[model samples]
Target: MAEDSSWMTAGAGECAPSAELHPEIAHPARIYNALIGGKDNFAADRLVAEQLSAAVPETVAGAKANRAFLGRAVRAAAALGVRQFLDIGTGIPTAGNTHEVAQAVDPSARVAYVDNDPIVLAHARALMSGSGHGATSVTRADLRDPEALLAAPGVRDLLDFTEPVALMLVAILHFISDDEDPYGIVKQLVGALPVGSLLVLSHGSGDLVTPEQAERAERSYDPAAAGIHLRTRDDVARFFDGLTLLDPGLVIAPHWRPDTPPDAAADRLGIYTGLARL
Candidate 1:
């Protein structure tokens, strides 16, 4: 790994939003942290998480399943000899981070994590200290801005554009509404990479959740947090367009190459996940 310590010097001013942290508002990352039983979230995040859990009892389980699917996807990519990873929308650093899983499989693996949340970067910096010095770096960039995210110093420093990279979009695409041209966003990011690159994605689905449950969940994030837009399985499958989907294409989170026997309860999580290669 080459030394590009410039990414270290670039502070939040360079890539992060200038707005102050609003503890009163429920952020998607913090709420996800709370749902995963992490202690990094605040009162507002916990409140919204709890409300969603009450409305959709499987919501918590769905979050956990999504994380597990991410780990499995990363490991599978590593097995395929893909060493570089660009994980956009990486929530609060939890147990199996992208760099952790990829590096475990191959020590030389490099990961660039992109998130818009300042708190996530704060925790990530602390977690990365004294570890993964050259192999891992975090950047503040929104998925909506593919050019800025692709050009971010951290991403440019850690990942080689010429090489095969695994682009992980786990549980993050839902925040991007149709108006944002989520499909075009995916294509733009994928287009920058060379052939043989992989796209690993897990998205929230409305196919399983009842209309009432979906309405309640959307209401929870209406004012304070980023709005939720759960798509159908067919809609999510469109994300892998023109790519080769691996076995068990576009299934629920836990069903995509699970290490354990598929749990019947996982089907209720309302998340569609898949791994595809260009």
Candidate 2:
């Protein structure tokens, strides 16, 4: 590999998808991007985001809190000498991306971002194309198919399976319904990685929201869009089963080892997050 900016497109082949982008429908990636104040989303995504926000006034703040949690977690992993990252369900790239946080710790860090949406793949390619540092790549792959994702060239190219890797599943697992066997999916991905590897994840929670608010929020994600399935703390904790959970296990997103003292509003984020070692 020539490295340098050349490595920016090192895994371009992995992100190409046969499915076309459906701009008319609301997509999870675009909605999240819009919540984070990114310009990559369409009006459909904005509608869904606004609907959710109206139902749960705290949603926009919650989404930003989730992003902050991601940054803190990635930086913590990087601090622990994790130079490689496999970030699945990586939505539209915004401020504090995984590679940005990891590379801040070590310039040579490598990251492979995976997402199923074609629009996300396109925006990811554009946002990341010329980073000119670290081995960063984007791939279009479904999180449900861990086998295919693990076999993707983008992952195999940018990350060495033999070493300790940080697998990030931030705010994405909720898209998977119970019938999808989400736990099994996590197990398959974690089992493939070497010993001492880490699993870092954040998921949506309905513990704080009223039933009416949760139902209204759910309606925003129509059948055409990726459906949301919020779980409770106990349900979210199951994903970290069989792995050693780090301190402050499975708390609301902003409360997880915050760089600054967490405020009372941090509890209203309506998300749970944790880091675990295999």
Off by over 4 Å in 1: 1-19, 132-134
Q: List the residue pairs that clash in candidate 1.
A: none
**Which candidate number maximizes TM-score?**
2
Give TM per candidate.
0.92, 0.93
RMSD values for the candidates in order, in angstroms, are 3.9, 3.9
The C-alpha local distance difference test score for the whole of candidate 2 amounts to 0.84
Q: Write the per-residue lDDT of candidate 2 for residues 102-214, one digit (tens) a residue.
A: 98899888898888877767777777666464688877678877888887777777789999999999999999999989999999999999988889999998889898998
- Stretches of candidate 2 off by over 4 Å are 1-8, 11-19
Q: Residue 98 in candidate 1 has what lDDT?
A: 86
